[model samples]
Target: MIRHLVLFKLNEGVERDDPQVVAGAEAFRALGDRIPELRFWECAWNISDRPIAYDFAINSAVEDTAALQRYLEHPAHQAGVALWREFATWVMADYEF
Candidate 1:
């Protein structure tokens, strides 16, 4: 099993409170249902880690890193990333067992 997580901070030019950000989060949450390899997925808008520098985050679980790699290269993910880039300023990550 593997846990892959990413955190995104949208540019100041984009609205942090925008509905689409929320929508995108929900979209990510729904991917586990859409893609079988994804054991679970969750997207969050706020974090209590007050000193951190991320605006939003995506946390997902997969059967393995191979599944994650396949998911990363999938067309649906490409489409989703394209949509996500519109609101994202910088994206960061943390991946592990």
Candidate 2:
């Protein structure tokens, strides 16, 4: 399986605990149920970076890189990109074992 991980930093005016952040977290957590190619999805918030925890994160498990690519191009995900424009920086990494 391929593990697709992502993290985000919100725009300057956005609060870490804002409703948009909360909603995005929930939406990501629900992707597994909405997308057939998604084997698993996890969403997280309020991780303490000072204590070694990272920013908001998503860990998606897919059957292969092709499946992950499909997920990346999905319309639903595109919609999310629009809604999440307030995010400042987004980073992603993939690993397979």
Candidate 3:
């Protein structure tokens, strides 16, 4: 399986409660049902307040690189990425396990 993980940090001056952030989060939350390649999904606001911590996280799994690619290319996922691009910066990692 491929494990895909991501961490997000809101742009400067962007509040966690901002409508854009909330909407972006909701969009991500809805992906599990819409994307068949997603075998596991867990996206959420980070509970940690540590200075080094990111504001949000996405932990998901897929069958393989092909499934991961399909998930990345899905229209819903693309929309969510665009929404997040407006208010946040993120980092991701994918590995086979």
Best by lDDT: 3
Which candidate should be chosen as best, given TM-score against the real structure? 3
Task: Give residue 3's lDDT in candidate 1 (0 to 100).
Answer: 82
Q: Which segments of candidate 2 are over 4 A away from where they belong?
A: 49-54
Could you give the candidate ranking by lDDT, starting with the highest? 3, 2, 1
Worst 10 contiguous positions by lDDT, candidate 3: 41-50
Per-residue lDDT, model 2, residue 15, is 73
Model 1 per-residue lDDT tens digits across residues 21-75: 6666666666767777777787777656576667777788888778988888877
Off by over 4 Å in 3: none
Scored by Cα lDDT, where does model 3 land?
A: 0.97
Query: Can you write out model 3's per-residue Cα lDDT over 1-97, one digit (the tens) per residue?
Result: 9999999999999998999999999999999999999999999999999999999999999999999999999999999999999999999999999
**Would you list the C-alpha lDDT of every candidate in the order shown?**
0.72, 0.75, 0.97
The residue-level lDDT of candidate 1 at 64 comes to 73
What's the number of clashes in each of the models? 0, 0, 0
Q: Which regions in candidate 1 have their CA more than 4 angstroms from the true location?
A: 17-23, 47-51
